[model samples]
Target: MGIDPTNPTGIKAFVFDVFGTVVDWRSGVAREAQPFLNRHAPDLDVSEFVDAWRREYSPAMEEVRSGRRPYVRLDVLHRENLVKVLAHFGIAGACEPEIDELNLAWHRLDPWPDAVDALHRLKRRFIIAPLSNGNIRLMVDIAKRGGLPWDAVLGAEVVRAYKPSPRVYSETAEILAIAPRELCLVAAHNNDLAAARRVGLSTAFVRRPTEHGPHQTSDLKADEAWDFVVDDLHELATQLGCAR
Candidate 1:
């Protein structure tokens, strides 16, 4: 029943994890940040700067997730970290708008070479949407930038809850007017799929072992038995029985 469209039993939609799954956020974010870092802190090691920014990512989100602080989107958390990181690097004279632009590095990610074509193929057979922890505006901007053909963009902004939260999964199902099992979440990160599975959504894991570049230590392979484990989105479309 959860087979997305080619199987006799129907699965109506596919919810994708945008970052690192469909788009190469690690490389994209680093590329976008380099020029800004050069202009601000020319002597600084931009790669380490990029890695440091990412290092703060989980902790910042955890603060919000743990309710030690109120809910804050990744964008906000990124900015908060950027300001501190830049100051520590002795980067000065940047205005608020510049800082904000740097923070949006996540939004301007480049899609994997196969991402666009794969989604086009899958869309013919399933309703495709983004289900991510990114805020709505950020996710929409990414869709526009990366040419992601999502039927709808769903994000933490809509649910005020992050993935791994049952409420977020249920809210996405309700918005799409489909049952939980009818929506499959395709992701590169196992934790994301694990969360989707807990809520009854079928999961697909597309391994992006080098997503973190040389910085990657985790998510090197699918640790859990996801419904499907493929190398990329195009492969996913093929497995779901989409032709071409």
Candidate 2:
């Protein structure tokens, strides 16, 4: 059955997929990496480096999702991946502190221009939080830096599993004390929404066409007929009857 955006009566909460949906992770990571790269591997393309780092994200989490490794926070995985990415680029000799600071780029990501205001508008009518792969601290820092008004922070650390895992979606609803059907997952990625829908949550797709960069080709349009599909958070807010 399809959801009616204008009258989503039972949805008490709106949980977001943060990285590319709410925050521009690719550009933000490249921006934060610029100074460090200039000092280290000046010749390395910042965009390429950021993409390489992002490519490591899912595989690292799969280790935990598959239960091959115990759950460790995203920060730890990012740092470990950072070391490898640095090595891959032949940019050796980065100190521990340097790598640690650079890994924090995830925390400093910028929101889409429509995000903060749309979230605030949505917040007035429903519970709003992140259902991201990022750990608590990472989510908190991103929210703080970007002025996102979340009622609570939630994700991998809280659930002990990364996204696309049924537990991540079902457990989040459990934590929020709402039925899975009463919670909605808003994301730019169809796979994330598909997982949420599989677990009985409503799903919304917000387009971030340039999330991966100008030449990006994937996830430009909704692959499935999600509960709601909008060009940006602002449109979602409007469709959901949020005040200006």
Best by lDDT: 2
lDDT of 2 by residue, 1-244 (tens): 6766666567889999999999999999999999999999898899999999999999999999898999999999999999989999999878888999999999999999999999999999999999998999999999889999999998889978898999999999999999999999999999999999999999999999999999999999999999899999999999889898
- Deviation of model 2 at 94, angstroms: 1.4
Provide C-alpha RMSD values for all models, in order: 2.2, 2.4
- Go through the candidates in order and give each one's C-alpha lDDT: 0.84, 0.93
Could you give candidate 1's per-residue lDDT for residues 133-209 as a string of tens digits? 88988888888998988888886878887777777888898899998887888898888888888888888899887
Candidate 1 Cα deviation (angstroms), residue 238: 0.4
Residue pairs with backbone atoms closer than 3 Å in model 1 (clashes)? none
Candidate 1, residue 231: lDDT = 92
Structure candidate 2, residue pairs in collision? none
* Candidate 1 ranges with C-alpha deviation above 4 Å: 1-5
Give the top-scoring candidate (TM-score).
2
